[model samples]
Target chain A: MRVPRPNRAQLGAGALVLAALSVGRVVTEWLPEDPSPVRAFERTTTLDREVHLRYGNLRVTEVDGGKQLATSTSAMLSPGLWVTAHVDFTPTVDKVGPAYAELRDGEGRVLTRGSRNVLECKVINPGISGHCLVAFEVDPTALAGSHLALTVNVNDQRGDDMAVVDLGITPAQVATWKARTTPVELLMPKDAT
Target chain B: MAPVGMDGGTDSLRATGRWGRARQWLATLTVRQWLLAAFLLVLVGSSPFGGLRAQRAEATPTLSVGVEQTVAPVRLTVTKVRFGSDLGVPQAAKIDGRYVVVFAKVTGTDEKRSVPMYDALRDLLRIEQVPGVTKPFSTDPEPSSDDLRPDTILVADDAERMGDLAPGLTYTLAFVWRQAPGQPVPTSVRVAAYSHTFRQASIDDTYDWRDATRAAVGTFPATAYEKPAAS
Candidate 1:
């Protein structure tokens, strides 16, 4: 009868593997409930080192990678208007997930919840990047002449992980847009600003 | 049934193990694998990898809480200048082809989750604190006083086209908590009044929220309605 022979190399390898396995287990179990849903990503940012939040990539482009707006349309937005974000989600298998955007009011009130969806990719692949056309209506009644902030979440499934992006509403531009372009036929806010 | 069959079974098992490991690595990250190993380590108490991964898995199911706002104040910062040409009426008297985009972020630390981002925002904005002392700044403790709403908020001349305001430029906007009162104001502030100059425009800007970032202040700046002179 030959007893199972364990060489030093095998023994060392076994020990390392065991150690790694144990650490993983402890960490997972220890992570608090609802562990940080945000998956760390090393992408571009518009924030300084002090800022923990930044918009990675939520630029707008016509479908099929169309030309960007020649000049920013910062001067024409008015209160009570609808703006469509031709959001293009990516690389993830889900082209369209639970898509939605958030809007907060001057008083930290949530003015809107724009649903986000990977309109083109959910059913196809979980890792394939896709796009979603999210619709968000600007808040016309915020305490300030306009509201700020737009956060988006795109996911493949309901409970599965989600991709988030933060965007800041251009205030001066919004104000300028509101004052210059509002039409007459449509009763607009009284000339207050 | 025979020695030959037994040898074949052993070979198959070894092949299966190798394939499984490779596939697992592809699907998960190194840290994840390490975590798995550790959990299993603890789960089984010891198994080379100590089955730490298994142990962790068995420890407890994290309570996932989707952070978002069920109801929040009407906050939307978007600006686009619409010329009369865009509105098919140079003197359309209102903004017409304009677009403003808002951006925000949400972090989840709760135990259970569902649409965490939106949910958390809604919750935070809705049913604010009880001002005066524990909730002083609220001004009014009532619902209407706080301006908290669940659906979309609009501060336009009309409610029908609330989501589609007449395109125009030079209007006060909302900045829930992005920049601040005056410091770091938006890139450019439209200073014209009903001047149909630029049309079909979009402003890539953000609202004032420096105070919020500091977690020291509230009262974000937004486009307030400068009431009409009692027409």
Candidate 2:
């Protein structure tokens, strides 16, 4: 016939529990889905053709690497080889963000520019074309048929529109490059030749 | 039927008595006691949210212009602000309104590594037309007298000029902001440089611009403005 009322302390505790559950639920529901590191992206077999992206077109001219790492001042040795891609960017957007390179090997090993030494060229303006070198220091053995993924507007953190360039390096080509690897002089884009 | 009616009446009386007793209990507390109880309730109510946050000290002072402001690898100086109507620029280069050009110098202070000065510079340099709001305009929106690279903060190096700073180098750069159509040109403006950690996602791109250490380069009066003939 009678109902027992909860005291202030008990009511407050219940409210606190409810808020905690709500906050937890929102966090779980709103967090971005983790991208699969091994997931396949749209692949471009050729690099010279204009690869269209949301902001602009990119033409990756060359992708090369071996054991030798060279700078103007000195040459350094690495446990793995360096992979460099010379890319030309033509912007179509007003505020263009920076782009980074990722290297994925057949064994599912992935390496980003953050993980290795690199010299990058930035394309920030839309009025003129820009060139950048996105390099990654990766395991020399992984060079056999690895994919060099270039994602533009990387700072936007949207994580879409990646141009995956297949390195197309055969095991024999890797062997030849390894045997003939020479110390490369790190030069400015103008002095790259 | 008679017993059911009696039971219903008893239940109603019991509910009324319970509420009356609750109100009587509340009335017995003095004003000071009531205030204390209310404060305690608020404190307990906020405990879950408040307890989670670590207490932080006051924020760092904002950096001012005419002074060299350093944030780790990058050191910036905002030297001057100039306003122009036509700017003697090419027709294609002209904006819908006017141009407020800011001249600043950035140097890479770190000897160990080359700072991505362009990314930091873009994020740090801003024109404060109003007090708090910073307008986002395209940097070097159009072609100009100086041969400027679209992506670079530097003009194509002439016989005398050096471009964006390499490590241990200081380079002077200009940023151009356009006045919105129908908006009066700002008579007085403040140029500000922000200090932030050099992350791949740039300070401006990732965090709130206010959170960074803001250094006001300088405030300029109307006399500093320049007017050039439009093509």
Candidate 3:
């Protein structure tokens, strides 16, 4: 006729199972999928101005490339409409991957550096600041409203953290860049000038 | 002290008997039974299957020739393979072994998705001398025929590479690998393209190509190695 009460062992087991389930749910909810949670940290900054990123500060020192750099007389790279930028970047912390540059067209299409082009700006190490040049081959038409983006990705365990800056370019400037055919040296951090 | 109606001595004896029986039953268990119990306990204690799945997800899958496969935006096909010292380009340096020339055709399969331009170097394209083996020969590609010379061996560093490919556009890429002089010519060669995938809007954001279980394009019987000296 008396009601029963759960003793210590039974209550302890129940608490343990509930704890395990709570931990499992938290873990499953935290796991990332296609649109990863890490992408939420992706930040884009405007160029020619110093933009503070989680890892570093980046500024476009100069942007050069055009018909001249790609011409037969001083063909620094393969025959294409190429645009190159001089960047000054300083990493405040240890960044994981190489720093890379991407060029986007007026229509928001992306243009990577030509596969064979020699000029590539690499990532700078923490405490080491220097000059580097990044180049990309793009259709001449994209020059007018194109944006040159520079990014340094942080390889954090939880998700990826990247600092990106977009520098707007002009068509007349691209036309002028096409005429500077002399090959600019690609200077990576720790490389001998 | 004893309850008015219950006999405390009898209840104590029953409890002792129950404890003895339980101990005896456990002691009777064989080593095999103990091991099986431990295995089940481990299985229930910590499930490791979830960690295994997480590991497999990050593992990069290899890409191969002839197979019409899509790792999102990039669809690759190895149309023809030729092996000879002088098929595509003359070697710049005399070597003991022959050359393996692979001709691959690549296209963007999806308009919404885009991948980084394929580079023979960056894509990690290499040929396995024996099919399915992990041994990768130092490989380079002649993306264009302009640099090939009949009289001279082509410089590996000077090899041209394919450019960034957009949707609705296709490019045929040529790759070259050297088989060292004394090594037995591979009975069959497996071509692998270790490429990365990215979205068009976030082209810089990249992910390794996975999804397909097998990275190998269909393996083809090796072309007989004709020693250049014989020719």
Candidate 4:
């Protein structure tokens, strides 16, 4: 005579597992630690770029944050990145002091030694005014699909916060996915309370 | 009144015989098959699932979200921000009112949404009363801020970009939840403003900061940017 396998017990265990899966789904929503919206994220970034500067005539226009939508281009690279930010300012007040500007990577590592100069402006709106223009460049070693965060450092006061923007190296049709995600605000009349 | 037909005893016996046949047939069915038949009968039955569904419903409670809707307008405030070398603000301001980008995050169970700065400011967004133009541009997002909300179309002649908005112009935006239609419209938003400041003149002794400002002036950067809500 041969010993029989406990097929009935095996069936009972399988049934229990199925029941657990069902109940687990029921309670998933109640978990507090879950990330609110479902997102597609990678384990490590391929590319990362950042820009920084300070306030005054030399680098007047600060764009604390901007956005870049996903591109339809090939996203197979380990890390590929590119960012272009332009700012223009008029220096009406000539400052005898030399100002410095440079771009920094996410790790707080300086990508390039900063360069600077003075502005020429005759019009003074506040204490004084001058004209100036500046641009920040980043290394293309970051993930193309990842976000760009940058800051401007001048004097001792660094940019108050990070300006966030998205990168759209993907195809144009992906623009639709981005458009749908934008917010629609409900505002009051100018004169309303 | 007795007709020649049949006796009461015969009629009673015939009815009892039919009931007996049905009971016998039901008894012959396998236990599993019998249970299946009972389930089917419950499905199409008039008494409504009998009892099984009631227990399941109690154990699996769910909130029906995105069902109701409210057209109620939500109010939000946007400052008339203009920064530049002249602005002397810690941060530079674009002609369209500085702050190239802003990220707004809302909390609570209701959920938060993101819109372009111009779209968020549409309602309260005014052009500071310019002359020459007979009618001003409408303060509405062309692509619409609401994903599911209907769009209010504008004529081609009336189309304009966010760059057209100037500083000193005030604007407000509205928000409403359709699924929660019964909820009241948000009247006002408490705004908290903070600015990051830094300094750098574009002139590398040789770089022409003046020429750059001159170029930026008059011309406009009409790009629109929206930040995703933080998860």
Best by TM-score: 3
TM-score of model 3 (CA atoms): 0.47
Report the C-alpha lDDT of model 1 over A54-172, residue by residue, as the tens digit: 33223333211111111121222332444333443333332334344443333454433423111221222444434444333444333233222223353212333323333333555
- What Cα-based lDDT does every candidate model obtain? 0.30, 0.55, 0.52, 0.27
TM-score of chain A of 3: 0.58
Sort every candidate by DockQ, greatest first. 3, 2, 4, 1
User: Measured against the native two-chain assembly using Cα atoms, what DockQ does each of the candidate structures obtain, in the order listed?
Assistant: 0.02, 0.04, 0.12, 0.03
Q: B156-229 in candidate 1: lDDT tens per residue?
A: 33221122121121123211211112222222222111001112224522221111111111222223223236
Per-residue alpha-carbon lDDT of model 3 for B1-231, expressed as tens digits? 333235556867677777777877887887778889998887776675652223544544444446665544466676656565444323223444565666666665544323444332234345543321211333333333222221111112223344455334355655555544444556566665544444223465345343323234355556743434423
Residue A64 in candidate 4, Cα distance off native in Å: 11
- Residue B116 CA displacement from its true place in model 2, Å: 17
Better of 2 and 4 by TM-score: 2
Worst window of 10 by summed lDDT in candidate 2 chain A: A34-43
User: By summed lDDT, which 10 consecutive residues of candidate 1 chain B come out lowest?
Assistant: B208-217
Docking category for candidate 4?
incorrect
- Candidate 3 at A1: error in angstroms? 33
lDDT of 4 by residue, B1-231 (tens): 223234554655666666777776776777678779888787778356454455442221111212211111222222212111112211221223212211111111111111112222222122211111112232222222212221111111111112111111112211211111122222221222211111233643221112111000011121233322445
The candidate with the higher DockQ, 2 or 4, is 2
Ranking by lDDT: 2, 3, 1, 4
**Docking class of predicted structure 3:** incorrect
Task: Give the lDDT of residue B157 in candidate 4.
Answer: 14
In model 4, how large is the Cα lDDT of residue B80? Answer: 19
- Model 4, A1-193: lDDT tens digits are 2234669889899999999998998787665542223322211111222222232232323221112212122111101121332333332333322233333343233322222111112233433433322222222332233233333333331324333334333334233323343322112223221
Please give the C-alpha DockQ score of model 2.
Answer: 0.04
Per-candidate interface C-alpha RMSD? 16.4, 13.4, 9.5, 21.4
